[model samples]
Target: MLKNYVAYVRVSTTKQFIHGVSIAEQRRAITQYATLQQLNIIDWYEEIQSAARGRRPVFREMLKALKRHHYGLIMHKIDRGARNLRDWADIGDLIDEGIDVRFTFYFFGGVVWRGTDKKIERVFLWIGGSPP
Candidate 1:
């Protein structure tokens, strides 16, 4: 019964527009996801913060929106999310609260975990993932 949908993209450096196409590529990927699912992205949040920084303003805004409870959150990649455990836990708490999460790429084929068990596996993947 999930209907609401939103897209989020981020880059560590603001110069990505000039140096590379990270943000553009991420947007295209998210757009593709939205198109495939026939969902209209109500909002697309983009931040210029590294995953190491837990207090990203745009990320905080996204969380506030998520908590307000409308649509779910979508992202280009999980690492675009958070590299630290605290940020990861914040996202986990959101998931526990029933906020839907979708990744641009399901490296593991959409393995959605609702319990703490698969969490360790995610942690392992986070630390030692091979390039895809």
Candidate 2:
């Protein structure tokens, strides 16, 4: 089981950055999920860069940091995550390396995927309550 987490939170607009509602919501959800799963959040990377730009220095730095550590990556959702195919491919590579990629929105006790040649490919279940 993965015990550590590094969070990546992003906002596309300056307005959202000023208001901070989206970022705060994501952080709250991530914190709740971590608490329920008994996981430690070791680091956080926040950026105000737009996804359309497709060049987030902080996000790239976060990926590099992941390589030197043994922790899962957590984001608010896939949409808040990789905004392009290249970024998605990077996430896939991390999964292939047996790292967990968790989304706060889909935190149904966490989604588990097999990284090896196993018949049981995936499993999903609720932790605190019924599916929302």
Candidate 3:
């Protein structure tokens, strides 16, 4: 069966958005990863909020939609998804509710992190070519 997903991208500063760190890059990375996994991106949520802050309106709305539709969530990285422990806890809650969370790019020689099991496992994945 094809998996459902909702993509999210965030930037901390306008400089990041302007100086080549745009949402397009994030979405591209996510799209690449999703294509590799054969997952369908049902929606996208982009935000210009600091991860240090837990109160993100678009993030909240995305969470509500994910719960309502029972779709998985995708992000560029773990830090991009949640910077603080509280925010991480919120994500953990979603995981407990049986939501799959996939991190597209990571420094650990992989482009995805599937977190839907009883114990989160770090499976290595390379989308395009050889891992750098």
Comparing 1 and 3 on TM-score, the stronger one: 3
**What lDDT score goes with residue 83 in model 3?**
84
Better of 2 and 3 by lDDT: 3
User: What is candidate 3's lDDT per residue for 48-124, written digit by digit as tens?
Assistant: 88878687889889888988888989888777778876776667778878888988775224433466643342211
lDDT of 2 by residue, 10-36 (tens): 998878875864888888888888887
Pairs clashing in candidate 3?
A: none
Candidate 1 regions exceeding 4 Å error are 18-21, 107-132
TM-score of each: 0.75, 0.76, 0.81
List model 1 lDDT by residue over 38-113, tens digit each: 6678898988878785868888888889888657778877888867877777777777777777776662247543
lDDT computed for candidate 3: 0.77
Candidate 1, overall lDDT? Answer: 0.73
Candidate 2 residues lying further than 4 Å off, grouped into runs, are: 18-21, 108-132
What C-alpha lDDT values do all the predictions have? 0.73, 0.73, 0.77
